[model samples]
Target chain A: MKKRTILGVRACTWVWLIMMGLTLVTYLIGQLGLGGISASLTVLAFALIKGQMLGDYFMGLKRISGFWRWPVVIWLFLPGGLISVAFTLVG
Target chain B: MQAQAVAEPIRYPPGDLAIWVFILAELAAFGAFFGAYAFTRMQHVELFNHFQATLDRDAALINTFALITSSYFVVRAVASIRDNNSQGCVRWLMAALVMGALFLIVKAQEYAHHIDEGIRLSTNTFYMFYLSLTFFHFMHVIMGMVILAAVAVKAKRGGYSATEHTGVETGASYWHMVDLVWLILFPLVYVMK
Candidate 1:
C-alpha cells in the first residue's frame, strides 16, 4: 500500500507516460520523413532524455550521490555525442 | 554543501552493486557497437538510407512501445515488492514477460519477412549489421525474460519482503538496461536518417 507518489500519481507512472510520449514524438518524426541535422538532433535529444529518465527513475539512480550516477549519464552521452557527430558528417 | 551531504545518508542504489557494474560493462559494449554503426553509415549514407527504408518502422515502433511498457511494468513490480506486495509484484513481472514475448513475436515476423526476401548476413553490409546487432539484442531480451521469470517465481513463493527484495531489483535493473539500450537502438538503427 506504499507508493512513491509525485503530484498525486506514482513517480514511475509519470516517468512511463512521459517515455511513451517521447516515443510517439520520435515515431512521428520518422513517419513524417524528417531528416537532417535538426531532425537528427531532435531524435537524439529525445533518446538521451528517455535514457536518462530510465536510469534515474526506473533504475533508481537519481538519489544516490558520487560515482554511481555517473556511469549511466556518461555511457549515454559519450556514445550519443559520437553518434551525433557521425550523423552530422552525412553531408 | 558538506553539511547537507552529510545530513542525507549515502545510500547505495536499490539493486546489487555488481549488477550495476555489469550493466555499465554491457553499456560500454553496446556503446561501441552503436558508435561503429553510426560511423559505418557515414561511408554509405545512401545505401544505409535506402535499406533503412526497407525496414519495418511500424514493427520497430511497436517493439519500442513493448519494451518501454515492459520496463514500466518491471518498475511497478519493483515498487510492489518495496511495499511487500508479493502477489502484485508477481503480477507485474508476468505482465512484463508478456510484453517481452510480444517483442520477440513481432521481431520474429520481421525476420521471417527478411528471410523470405532472401536476406542473409551476406546479403549486404547493412543487412549484416542489422541482423547481427538485432539478433544479439534479441538474445538479451530472451535472457531478460528468463531472469524476470525466475524472480517472479521466487516472488510468488513469498521469498521476498519489503526489506529483502534485492532479487527483484536486480532483475528489474537488468530489464531496464535492456530497455535503455533499445531507446537508443530504435532511433539509431530504425528511425535516424
Candidate 2:
C-alpha cells in the first residue's frame, strides 16, 4: 500500500509538471496573437489534451470502467469541437 | 491454492453518481453559452476581435496556471486520503485551497481592471459574454474552494479512511471539472480568433 501510494504521488507530481509546461506553451502561443484557423485549431488541440490529462489522470477516471469513462471524452470533444467549428467559421 | 474471487468490471461514473448528472447539466449550460458566443462572434467578427484585444491575456494565463495547480493539489489530497493519511490529506487540500484563492484574486484584479474601464455585462455583445461566462466560472472557483475547505475540515477531524474517502474524491471531481471548464473557456474566449 505504501509503495503504491508513493508511486501514485510521484505520477501525479509528474503529471502536474507536464501540465504546467503545456500551459506555458499555450500561453506563449496565445500571446503571439495566433489568429485564424490554424492557430485556433492548434490552441484547441492543446486545450483538449490538457483537459483530458486533468480528467483522466487527476480525476482518476482512467482507473475506472463502465459508462463513466465516456463522459470525459464527450465533454472534451463536444464543446471543443463546437468551438473549433465556430472558430473556423469566424476565422 | 485458494481460488481468487472473480474480478468484476469497475462501475461506471466515479464519485457520487449524482454528481455526474450535475456535471452533465453544467456542461450543457456552458456548451450552449459557448455556441452562442461563437454564433455571435461570427456575426460580429470585427467587433469580437477588437474587444478580444483589450482583455488581459497575461492575467488569464496566470489564472489558468493557478487552477491547473489547484487541480493537481486536489489529486494529491485524494491520493493521501486513499492512503489513510488524514494529516497529509489536509495539508494537500489546504494547499489546493490556497491555489483556488490565488485564482480568485487574479480574476478579481482582472474584473477590477475591466470595471475601471467601464466594462459590464451590458457593455456589448462581446463584453456581455466575457463578463457573464468568466464571472459565472469565477463563482464556480469560489464554490470549488468552499467544497475543498469543507472536505479539508472533515479530513482534519479524521472523517475519512483508506477504505472510505468518497468525499475527497467527490470534491476533487468537482474541482477538476472547474479546471476542465477553464481549459475550454480560456482558448475559446481568450485565444481563439
Candidate 3:
C-alpha cells in the first residue's frame, strides 16, 4: 500500500476509537448529574471533535481538491456559529 | 522517435455528485429541524429540561455507540471499495445495516415503554417534539438500510471497481449523515438538562 493509504487507515482507526471513547465519557458525565452548562459544553465539545474527525478522515476532505475543501470548511463552521447563536439566545 | 506518445486518457464516470447533493439537502432539512428544536426548547426551558431528565441515558448511550460503530464500518466500506475488496466492502456494509436495524429495534422498545407509561406524543409539547424528531430519525435509518442493502447486493455481484464505486461511496455518505444527525440529536434531547 502507498504511504498515504496506510496513513489514512491508521487515522481512521484512531478517529473511530476516540469517538467511541468520547461517547462513554459523555455517558459517565451525564450519570454524574452534570446536566447544566457543563454537560452542554461537554457534549458540544465531543460532537465537534467527532465532526472534525469524520470530516478529515472518513469524508476524505483532507485529501480533497483545494476547490472543494474551502466549501466544506464553511459548511462546518456555519453550523457552529448557528448553534452558538441559538444557545446564547436560549440558554 | 522514442516509444511514441500515450493514447487518450482513460475517462472515469463523474464522482458521486448526486449523492453529495442529496446529503446537502438532507443536512439543510436537519438544520431547520434543529433550529426549530432549539427555538422551542428556549421557549419551554423548564419543560424541556424536565423531559430530558426522564430519558434513559443508558439507552441513549448505547444507541450512540451503535450509530458510531456503524459509521466506523461505513468508513471501512468506503476504504475497502477503494482497495477493490468487494467482499470486504459487502461485509462492512452489512455490519452497518445490522447496526442500523438494532438501533431501530431498540428505539421501538423504548417507545413502547414510554407509551405503556402513558407518555404519548400528545402528552406535552416536549413529548410532541421528542416523538416527532426521533420518529423522523428512525425513518432515515430505515432509508439508510435500504440503500446499504442495495449497495451490498451490487458488491456481491462484483459491480464496483476501484475506479467506479460511486454507488458505495454515496451510500456510505448518506449513512454517515444519518449518524451525524443522531450525534447532535442525542445530546440535545437526552443530555441537555
What C-alpha RMSD separates each model from the true structure?
A: 2.7, 2.0, 4.1
| TM-score-better candidate, 1 vs 3 | 1
Better of 1 and 3 by DockQ: 1
lDDT tens digits by residue: candidate 1, A1-91: 6567888998889999999999999999998989888998899999999999999998888987887868899999999999999999885
Q: Model 2, range B1-193, lDDT digits (tens) per residue? A: 9989987777754477777788878878887888788878989888998999898889888889999998988888888888889999999999999999999999999999898988888889999999999999999899889989999999999999998988888888888999989988998888878
Error of 2 at A44 (Å): 0.3
- DockQ, computed on Cα atoms, for candidate 3: 0.41
For each predicted model, how many residue pairs clash, with residues at least 3 apart or on different chains? 0, 1, 0
Q: Which of 1 and 3 is ahead in lDDT?
A: 1
lDDT by residue (A1-91, candidate 3, tens digit) is 4424344656677788889998888788777878655567767678767776776677666666545554445554566556556666665
> Rank by lDDT, descending?
1, 2, 3
Docking class of 2: medium
Runs off by more than 4 Å, candidate 1: B1-7
Off by over 4 Å in 2: A2-9, B2-7
Most TM-score-accurate candidate: 1
| CA lDDT of every candidate | 0.92, 0.85, 0.78
Task: Return the TM-score for each candidate structure.
Answer: 0.95, 0.94, 0.88
Error of 3 at B12 (Å): 13
What fraction of native interface contacts does model 1 preserve? 0.75
Error of 1 at A8 (Å): 2.3
What C-alpha lDDT, on a 0 to 100 scale, does residue A13 get in candidate 3?
Answer: 77
